[model samples]
Target chain A: MSAIGDGRSMPTGAGLFDLPPELAIDTDVARRVIAEFVRGQLRQAGFERAIVGLSGGIDSALVAYLVAEAIGAERLLCLMLPYRTSASSSRTDAETVVERLGCAGELVEISPMVDAYFGRPDTGLVGAAGPEGLTASAVRRGNVMARIRMTVLYDRSVTWGGLVVGTSNKTEALIGYTTIFGDAASALNPIGDLYKSQVRQVAAAIGVPETIIRKAPSADLWPGQTDETEAGFSYPELDRLLFWLVDRRRSVEELEAKGFAPGLVQWALKAIAGSEFKRQVAPIAKLGPRTAGVDYLYPRRRPGSART
Target chain B: MQPLRIALAQTAPRLGLLDENLASHHALIGQARAGGAGLVVFPELGLTGYLLQDLAAEVAMRLDDPRLLELAAATASDGPAGLSAIVSFVEESADHRLFIAVALLEDGRVRHVQRKLFLPTYGLFDERRFFAAGDLLRATPSRLGVGVGLTVCEDFWHLGVPQLLALDGAQLLVNVSSSPGRDLAALNEIGLGTATSWRMLLRTYAQLTTSFVVFVNRVGVDESISFWGGSEVIGPNGEAVFSAPLYDEGLYFVDVDLGDVRRERIALPLLRDERLELAVRELNRIVSERAGQADDSTSEPGAEPGLDVAAR
Candidate 1:
């Protein structure tokens, strides 16, 4: 019932991160499996290079490191796409990752694209939405920003000939914190299964800069925005609740008995249920005799499906 | 008595590519023979890969397929130690029923075929939905001078399979698998919960059956699931003879003494003391009771749909 750091070989700088006892994994084994998984995915698809949307946040930074480790850093391209309101410190943190990994990094400012649709109040420029769009809600603008970044990444992928690797973790995907078809789209996701707290644990182990790992996790959609403050729950507590409820198949009553607040458990359950559609493929109406993803099931990488 | 060298081909098969995988098997068999291995084992569906939803039919081969015969011919080619290789693939019956099968090759021919018995249908496995479940379980004599039993992944999950194989006079039990890796947590010795579970099962079955248990699992990604290839060889006394690294693609060799089975069986005598009649009688009573056939049937009136039929 003890964590890995207690009796087993503690990872280097393990004390720097706060990992839940149950979420603490052997970093070595995780790296090995992920390296193989990343390589296998790329090999099956017949792609030699991979592109990652590198936010200064820990999740994407960890993904960049993993891709660099799996395939050589020479083949990895980290795109830092930031909006005008994004914190300057976030860009600095991303630069540190690129410097340490010695991988290709590009700065793609998304303000022009975003402002073109939402309009710019400062320059008094009227875009597609005119004056009304300038005063859009932070949520609407955040979704636009995410989709714009996705657009840029896919557009660049055509030129780079690299697959887009996903950075969203299990915690975000389960709670539906991602913008569907925006940030959630990827050719393959390696760490979509790791919780946020577990993401931090792996980030620390995989040599993500300590400042980035220790910094407050945020979407950087706006100034002073943070995920924990927005979600209203610490990741460790939320992850533990999710572990019992989803992974262990514990009933809400059992989760309450295990000392999780009933209200928190109920809210978490709601989020997971509401976000269910984002996790799977959109179902096709079963009108035909044989439908793809229905009766005509086939593996993603069939014989001729690989990129020749 | 010479120690038998087993070559565990922990390969990563291309998803739904039959000819490419067939070529790999042919080369690996020759390599294993050149290395002086008497026995070589490949993972379940190594010839056609796992996660082949509708592609199963496209890659399936019949028992009389010339490609299978040619692959078998690679095992015994005038080598000092004639090779006995257990290769797995999708089998197409005369009636066109697709089945996951394992064939034992010796003397340049298909010696015996063991179709996979338990088709796991729950969780990530959609096997039973596509392939037919095998009906027979028997041990065959091998060129290794001992009785051999062959099984697929989920076949060993049932406790009765290994026991039945051992009772049928098998000294070496071989299980080929394409088991997907999931359930990662800090609770297990290894980071993988699946590997932890499989490792425990291999050791336990080895000791209980008093037989050498050899497990060969594939390594590769099929869609979302990645197969963990921690292939292992367990001795008769539940000790690990050798363990291949997880997720690494290579041909690994392990030397196991066939005499160890005799030594452990005589010392433990667990198999000898097994009461087959008692188990059969209890099984029959339970089956009849569950079916509401016996007078002492404990089933409720509507517990099972067949109870009314039993009453009629």
Candidate 2:
């Protein structure tokens, strides 16, 4: 948790519970900015191609389209890694995006990796099958599936000759709704700054399929699982609170004054504070004067040579 | 002259988006006005993002454009009292040529427009292909009762523009730029970077001309370049009084003492002791007599060929 000068864990910027109309960005500006970011980040690393894990969700669909626009469809590779329990429509939707954008894509089955670890019932693991040996909890199976999918993506990265582009939006990132080292692993991200609501808006502007934008967001971890259903807070409400609390750095009292429910404010504050670790680099004890990532730092590029 | 409150709106402009960028300018102007600034400055091409290779014509606007007028009217008495702003944008002249220019607005109207004299075409800059060079150089009368000289990016690098403006009774020199940041490692210990050479140049100009220097630069990555937003205000004594954080957007308010302009000039006497007539006559002689021979490596080109160039 951040010990923000006032001992509160929040970022800077302010907003009310009701999403402000001004918060809606000009889509043209967003498209140009994101496209430029993708191109610039790749060019700096001396690469022109990017790979994305397409989940058939709004976030991944938007990212796939943006990357395709940045470095043409020939350079972008969209990989659909679906577990056995994943919905058939999700797979179909992912294929639809690939067809729409005309980008190269492949389906990698993640069922083997997930089932190999969790199929056994008597492991006594946290999310292992119960005494009846029926099934593992949804969280455990989801974590395994996420890690396996990332592993497959990274392995493909070698042959694909591209960096892994991130698909997590600001809302998921702030609430720590992503699996670390799994969906969160990426060489660079273009939409990390945009909130989920803003992501939907930009998706429409950038021609992400109407079906993808209209559907409810889900991690596809288990059957019938959706983000809003599990979280109990709608994205619009959460995004508005985050815009005020994180972006504007409003105090708890200020949020309450702006008509945010006390319980929701506390819950969001806790989530944001608890997830602070995922946002930064792992800390290293500074035994030496010039510790790495501390006093000793260099830019990604230098005069004599490029980084890669 | 009185002490003037100045605000430097260090902002990132979206490339080739005129309407959206103007909206950003308006928002920043409101913030500056709320901060009690009498004058606010924006970065170069603040109204039409930088790196506009071919889009310059698409977004080029005239001084009297209705959108600019709308921005000007923001400083009305309904907000802050007597607020004035200097914002940069691509300008389409009467003849349809485009020039990178800055507009000075006050009392709900554009009071002056200073076009960039030097169009940098080296390294990451390719301004010459898209923008025509401006020939005029002078200062405008600010509502704060001081002559505020305006420049855009490379114009200040020549050393002659600010000097000429100071000689023309300018008390403050403002340069709006879209300088990209490099050598970022050195910026922490010493405020120096690839683009920060302009900062040292401004400091020297402030020391020599005894005028307040205001520089506002944009931040954010564009294509492959990242503009460093180390917008700053230098006192007439060449010391920085206020500087915004690099790589971030902020509207920083600073109080500039115009009295320093008079105080430093009296102490240094650089402008007062200048041999204006001799310098002018010698420049004209060099231009007329040595026009061709100058590039041909003549032994004695100018009327005062043996004279030390710096002494003038």
Candidate 3:
């Protein structure tokens, strides 16, 4: 829908440069791979079902389809965790996926959880609760909403008997475009390897609604907030750059040689480097010879005989 | 040279479910045939599934087992011309020892059986404990004007497997694997996930060997392991022509020209420059020589005692 500004074309290199068409992943192969990943991650974690925080964005919608396909629709729980500021269309779009897939769906307004910390003045829980008690910045409030949504998803995981499936794509994950423990916290992520552009491709191949795919990419943190406009980078352009820079391991000079603008390349590389910590497990000191997450490397399905 | 139509079947095999998996092979072989593929490559232990600790013996199939004949028969019907398949399974050797093996089935019978040379034993892989390692390495010739070299999952990870296959005149290298997707979503230094690294390796092999590499990995979770099915067909130039998705199961097809192998070999003569004889001679010397007792008497002048020429 909203393609953002005139400069948006600069990043995508739509007219100036060509996105390597060959790098566009074969979607049929991607679907089967993701479906198996979902099923495998769940089975390893001893879960037959999955719970996804459906934001009605393309990423979540694609993940929902993959999780449903991996197990069955009946085994999936789609939670529309919306804040008061979340758009009505967000709820409707999420509901559409639930209805189409015939999976269980529930809507839990996150206003109470968020407002409990920032909504009240007497609830002196955090610093910088302004004169009226709410955090002044939209960014700060957005982070709270994200964290609350994750809390609800994990809490639901107990009763729903499913792993929390992540929806963040490779583009966002690389750019540190996701909330640290919020949308990033999941038992298994099937779409994390796919770039945002590839996410749209695989989403279309898997039959996600066109409306969801074409809509302006956003985290819906505040009214009128969109990802592209705020980040000053278009996903298509960013995905292309990331594919070459990260996946292809191309240097900034090589990217420039490939016709990418120098400024955009620097910005993307810095974003990727800065966010590198988010993509890894928290470092654990190896006090012992075989510390967990160190030499004590075991698969998610270890003690395999116990499951039987 | 004729272009080879190859199919990589990235399927999830249920553990020890030989009957069901064989039927699955039958269906997939038909699918590949219908898609005009001359050869269909399935994942490692595709018939028995991975993480088969005790179950490996239960599903161990003999080379002459009737189930294999049925699979060979699936390629019998009218479909693609010169259709053949390399399917992986646990083999019950004549001596009753189990081996992880790939069967080259064509013309309604078993053509050749290539067992896994390296049985991985580290981290999530207990293959060595359950199965015997194979010592032989060779390639099978196809009627479609291409020599097909077959290797089980871990075989390709070890050095020299690709070189050995190429030396034996293999233009196409097919690696069948049931490699579980560990750290499925975790990114490595360059931002590639663990599963994606597998594709990168296939690309490197294809490029270095000047051969078409068909890497078919299984999809689905077995016990606590989830096999990341990113089956791919890498061109001789190391470019990925087709790659199946991360954890899904299906038959993916790619048309690889055997002529490209020749062209690439001519263009980048890595294989042509290979010193196979030198390597063979050195390996023969190393394996045959026994470790001599420490002798300081024949030591070189001004040399350390352990570094003596007599020790060498």
**TM-scores for candidates 1 onward, in order:** 0.96, 0.53, 0.59
Q: What TM-score results for chain B in every one of the models?
A: 0.95, 0.90, 0.89
lDDT of every model, 2 decimals? 0.89, 0.80, 0.79
lDDT of 2 by residue, B180-291 (tens): 7543221123333444576678789999888999999987666556676788899999998887876667788898778988889889999999999999986876675445
Q: Rank the candidates by TM-score, best first.
A: 1, 3, 2
- Model 1 chain B weakest 10-residue run by lDDT: B303-312
Off by over 4 Å in 2: A1-20, A120-136, A301-308, B1-312
Residue A176 Cα positional deviation in candidate 2, in Å, after optimal superposition:
0.6
How do the residues A80-106 of candidate 2 rate in per-residue lDDT, one tens digit apiece?
Answer: 999877999899999999999999999
- Which candidate tops DockQ? 1
Residue lDDT tens for model 3, A1-308? 11435422111323322233534554555566567567666655567888999999999999999888879899999999988779999999999999999999999998777776676534555533445555457777777788889999999999998888888888899999888898888878888888887777667668898889888889898778899999998877888888878767798788999999999998887898999898888999868777776655434454342232
Cα lDDT of model 1 by residue, B35-81, tens digit: 98999999999999999999999999999999999988887659466
Give TM-score values for chain A, per-prediction: 0.95, 0.87, 0.88
Backbone clash numbers for all candidates listed: 0, 4, 13
